[model samples]
Target: MLVALDGVPVGSQDGTQLGTLIPVTHLRLPPASRMEFIVTGPSENVKSAQLITQAIVTGPNGDNDTARTLATLVAREEDDDSNVSRVPNVTGPPWTPRFAGLATAAVNTTRRLYFSENAAQTQFFITVAGQTPTVFSANNPPAVVTTQGSVEDWIIENRAQENHEFHFHQIHFLVRSQDNFAINGSQPVAAIQGQMMDMIEIPYWDGNPNHPYPSVTLRMDFRGPDVGDFVYHCHILNHEDQGMMAIIRVLPQP
Candidate 1:
């Protein structure tokens, strides 16, 4: 059976067919990836259109080689304006994203720190990845970055079965040491990496050469003039709409 989603063929369960998945990256650049697969033969009348642009954290489903859904944090309704600008403050040492990656849960339902495969709990602030309610719950939550000239190690984890190009709005990073390991263990010192992206390309959770998991190591550089509240998330349109999105507020120069 062909799983035609939004007019685009994603995949089939029979293991005899393939579909086109759009990779939207750098919102300004549109779709920049094209994958050709031998699915029942390449016939005419096939639509030549792009689907998504950037990274969408997704995993493999039970019966198909295709993806499941976009990984994201729940968004507030259009009419809701109470917590939109909310900014939760951190008093102690800034919580390192690497440390958050170490948070654990008792069961699949447990969303104490990091998210699991379970959909319902994935939105919770499991390991501190993005700006979550628990992390930024105040009215007009201040930017996580403090004074200007602040540079930090931002980890773009490919937990989804796919890979992603995590593009940033103002900074361009360098490739440090692309690697992979248990993303949910207590190893704050352990390094996690992938290809360095001026625009971080986060592969989907289900992405792999033969089950691809392209983890890139990047060194993000942030300074003055470009410091402000800007978006730093996936470039895929549909996935961005789902919840694969976030904002980063860079402090101004002193």
Candidate 2:
């Protein structure tokens, strides 16, 4: 089903404010799935309008099953719009209460880990100046080791011609910085760095030394129950099959 405001379906909701204007250009919805959106009037003076939900169902043999109107919404104007206006603004500065200590730990225990694809773009490996690149081997030693109660920062660099997604199995990480040739910057506030994600994208590098390589600074958290051996690799399946993956060991802390 599609949610349309002013006869247009918006792709996705990026903001959650009640009265904030959200642009609806174009959107596509798959069958049997539900989607939610915040619909706002195109203009303040346009008091009354229709909200239409349409469902397009397709059959397995490339034939159309049904095209039907799901629901019609009638927007009623209130005598006083003051109630909507009085709602407190919800979007603003980052919430920093729980992030202060984590930020400090990340800064103090920073660890750098570099990743890049082999020149053939078939194998994945981590690079260090003095040592040979550590290529993938199921029985090979763990490329990275950390204590179970530590937080360490990893600088993941992408040297492949195509984009690769970095993923870890047992623990999530915080994106401290996302920088490369395109946008060279950090999160607006330290609080915004609190996002805990298990995967993130590493943009492609053209193999130019002068140009900044696409990299992400991730603060990995091992303070949870995750321990023993786990794998971190390029989420791309073919890349992983071709040797772009490594094992990481998290030792139980004393």
Candidate 3:
């Protein structure tokens, strides 16, 4: 179980420090998601505190994430390491982001992908646009292909009834936007926008056909030196084992 600190989020998983710290009491982290936060030590008057996680319901039929205590926090004695550096109360000085120019960088291509599962939830798929959904196989050709140094934008929609985590290997992506979800007042979503991350969660869609499926748009950067085939998939072990994954081939730059 991943423990969430009851404090302020200072940085994201990809090491992009936030311009401003966002205070949160309970941070929800899905599979493969990561966050960095600052937790102040307990006051002298406080004896101990428990680090715990709250229960979460992924879907109507999905497994339950049970709440549990992870550890006990106790204040240190006055004589114990007075030289220990104190955690700053304020957000630190500004710094440039690693992908500072990515927001406005020219997009080389755009693609759409979606997640779907069968009624029995035994089979799963991550399908590219204009293609038939098929179980993932190593023998299968790459579902998507691109050349190195290309910046592409992908829209990933979740058509399943249970939540799905989108994870990419070999590179991180910037989350551009979220659509068709009621997140107008979500502090976590607001705090995470524009950060580079290797994983993100797409909420489950209701069965109603009139309701649009939940989706997230991502800005993928393939400008790094790495080149070759890598797989992107739902981080959930069961889902991944059931074929909710696909390969992307990144050709070497000429």
Candidate 4:
């Protein structure tokens, strides 16, 4: 859970400080996702505060994560001379977005990928555009091949009834946009908008032919030095094990 400190959101899960603070009661966190928040202690006569997570219904067939208390906050006396120091107000210079350049960088390729599952939901597939959907296996060849130092925009659509988290190996990607997320009422909080992250949750599709499947557009950065076969998949272990994974081969720059 992304716990808001005093009901305010101040930073991104990727460690980038948000340009503006957004007030939110709580934020949903999928597996492998991270977030940073600043919680201020109560100034007045509040005895204690509890940090808790409400139950989350992942999907029709997904597990219902039970609500739990993460921690309890108790305010110390003002006159107490304990060594614990209070959290000070933020006073540094404004934060600069790490992937600011990617916002305008020309995208070398635009690709469409999608998630699907069998009728019984026993098997899953993450397939590339114009290819047969196949379960992931070590024997399978790289599903995607790209050259080093190239940037691509990937639109990942979730066609399943349950949510899935998209996780890329080796490099982080900027979240360019989320399609049909607001309509599903699961849009990301303002603080994480445009943030660079390795993993993000893709909400489920409602199976309506007229409505588009929920999708997230990411700007993949393959410019990093690492170049080899790496896999990207749904972070959910069960789904990945069933077959929602694929390999991307990044060859050395020409």
lDDT of each: 0.38, 0.57, 0.79, 0.79
Writing each residue's lDDT as its tens digit, candidate 1 over 166-200 gives 55565544444444433421111111122223443
Better of 2 and 3 by TM-score: 3
lDDT of 3 by residue, 52-112 (tens): 9888767665678899998998766566786778767776875555555677789999999
- Show pairs that collide, candidate 4: none
Tens digits of lDDT, candidate 2, 1-254: 22432222232112222222334442433222223365555565664555444442211111233545544554556566565655356657633232234545744365555666655555676553245676678898877777888888888776655656677787766667877736422112222233445666665665556767678788877778888999987766666777777778999988
Residue 180 displacement in candidate 1 (angstroms): 2.4
Q: What is the C-alpha RMSD of each candidate to the true structure, in Å?
A: 19.3, 11.7, 4.8, 4.5
Error of 3 at 161 (Å): 0.4
Tell me the TM-score of each prediction against the true structure.
0.41, 0.57, 0.84, 0.82
What lDDT would candidate 4 get against the real structure? Answer: 0.79
Point out the worst 10-residue segment of candidate 4 by lDDT.
1-10
**TM-score-better candidate, 1 vs 4:** 4
Evaluated against the true structure, the overall lDDT of model 3 is: 0.79
User: Worst lDDT window (10 residues) for model 3?
Assistant: 1-10
lDDT of 4 by residue, 89-151 (tens): 777876654454676688899999999999998899999989998999998999999999899
Off by over 4 Å in 3: 1-20, 76-78, 82-97, 183-188
Quote the positional error of residue 153 for candidate 1 in Å: 2.0
